[model samples]
Target: MPDHAILTADAHRDLRVNTERSAASGDAVMSAMVVPDELRQVQNEYPILFRRNLEHDRFTALAMFGFEDGENLFLEGTRWAARYLPLSIAIQPFLIGRPEGADTGVRQVHIDLASPRLGSEGLRIFEEDGSPSPYFHAVVEKLGMLDAGYQASIGFLAALRRHDLLEPLSLEVPLADGSTHRLVGFHVIDEERLRALDPAAVAELHQAGHLMPIFMALASLANIGALVARKNQRLRHG
Candidate 1:
């Protein structure tokens, strides 16, 4: 259960959050939700795939780290091997919150009191003078970027849907030990449809600032091979 509390300098002045990269810190996951804005950096390290939220009738981008649940191949003991950690993964134990019955569109920072990251021996949220610490500011920045990117992703997904550029993706990975893993229920940008799009359609997507991320998502598929290699290496060592 999550015990969420609105963050305030007085209440959380001495609060410290562990910054370790490990399974105990909640870094052991197969995938994390991603946004179009971060797709450029994400493409370099992880395969980008789309999954549908049936309840919300929406599609969300994902940065895949492994083939199964709770299996983070990029995580080596306490270290994450990726050059760039996705913002969604970096922003932990903190979430954007809205006050009840408020229509001002103001956002508040909420901290999970039950998070394992909350302890007495990590980064302080506030200084002795009750001001936000540098680490707090960085977390806020990541939260802001994540919030804005989530909003922008709506338009990006709409553009993809409008042009019929999304197609189902099913992957089969055969490890060196002859064990096979299959991943399904994901979608990817349809390169064939994108290539067949007329000039005017492409121009519209460009004007809407969705073309770059579309291409980045397509390019991210190349990392799938690397992910397979990591799985194989893990299997060989064990």
Candidate 2:
């Protein structure tokens, strides 16, 4: 369980968070939830796929880093090997919260005291004068982006569904060790359907600001081959 508390300079003046990229710092993962806002950058490094949330009965995007659980091929030693990281991965141990009985529109910064990244070293959250440090501000910016993206995604996904542009994706990935991994329960943009759409439909998607993200998600599939190469290289070196 997480011990979440509203972040306050007076309560946590000396708090420092480990910014290192490592499994010990909780960076190891097969995938990270992503939003359409970051798809332009995320497409360059990860395969963007959509996942269905049964409980919510909605779709969400994910940036895949590996084919299996607990595996992150992007991690090379203590450093991440990508030029752009998903906002969901960059913002850790910090989340936006609202005060109980207050307006739900109000956003406040909250910190998890039990996170492994919280330690005596690394980036400081606040200065001695009780002001937010540069690192803290950067994190808040990411959290804001993530929050806005999450809200935008509700509309983006609905547009895709309305257009019948999403389809199930099943992949059989073969590695150097003669083993095959089957990827299931993931969806991708149906390029065929997208291309077959009428001009009015295309205009609607473009006007709604969803066309580019759909194209970016299609482009991201190219990275799957590179991700497989990384897994093969890791296998060879090990």
Candidate 3:
């Protein structure tokens, strides 16, 4: 028997590698101001939400997304929130400011579940429950997925499934241009926040006694640890 079996037939999983972004140089975009009215445009290119106070094992903490104009600027965990979301892609070892290496530098793997070919139920799950997920507002309302956050989440999740991993513990996200999306068909969520949000729902899945979640979580972490090692090595020699 495999260590991690599929929690649901639609779970997503994958391995990715990338180096972190470059450091602040002569005149980097230190900060920018954004307003609720401008959120749509800003998130278009920078889909992932992040804040200065929150620290993901592999992200820089800074208030870069929101507005400095004083009308709800994104402050990350304090304002913009992000974490090791449940998906199925491994994006890490990104080279921003540091020299690149072979799986040598830290890699950020994005794990998610998404597919253009999904059922109605699948799509509903994602929108109903997801963090930093303003994407849902329009979804359930039968409005539209014109929101950037919603679209990014959907595309990112679907991309994961296209990559191979099954989607589990899913949610439905919207896409730009007013399109509904069944992001992760299902994904293993092992975060405290998730647990806190929906213990009953998770418990139901656990009762099924599937190790898929554990495997998914560990797989992502193992990949991260490997990249961290390479990063540490480079820093040590430098």
- In Å, residue 73's CA in model 2 sits off its true spot by 0.3
Q: Model 1 has how many clashing residue pairs? A: 0
Per-residue CA lDDT of candidate 2, range 101-204, in tens?
99978899999898899988989999999999999999999999999999899999999999999999999999889999899999999999999999999999
The CA lDDT of each predicted structure is 0.93, 0.93, 0.28
* Per-residue lDDT of model 1, residues 16-111, tens digit only: 999989999888899999999999999999999998888997889999999999999999988999999999889889998989988746899999
Instruction: Between candidates 2 and 3, name the one with more favorable TM-score.
Output: 2
The TM-score values for the models, in the order shown, are 0.97, 0.97, 0.19
Q: Least accurate stretch of 10 residues (summed lDDT) in model 1?
A: 97-106
Tell me how many clashing residue pairs each candidate has: 0, 0, 59
The Cα RMSD in angstroms, rounded to one decimal, for candidate 2 relative to the true structure is 1.1
Worst 10 residues of 3 by lDDT: 86-95
Candidate 3 lDDT tens digits, 6-121:
22213421111111222211012223322222233333322222222225322111123212223221222222222321111101111012125646343222222232122332
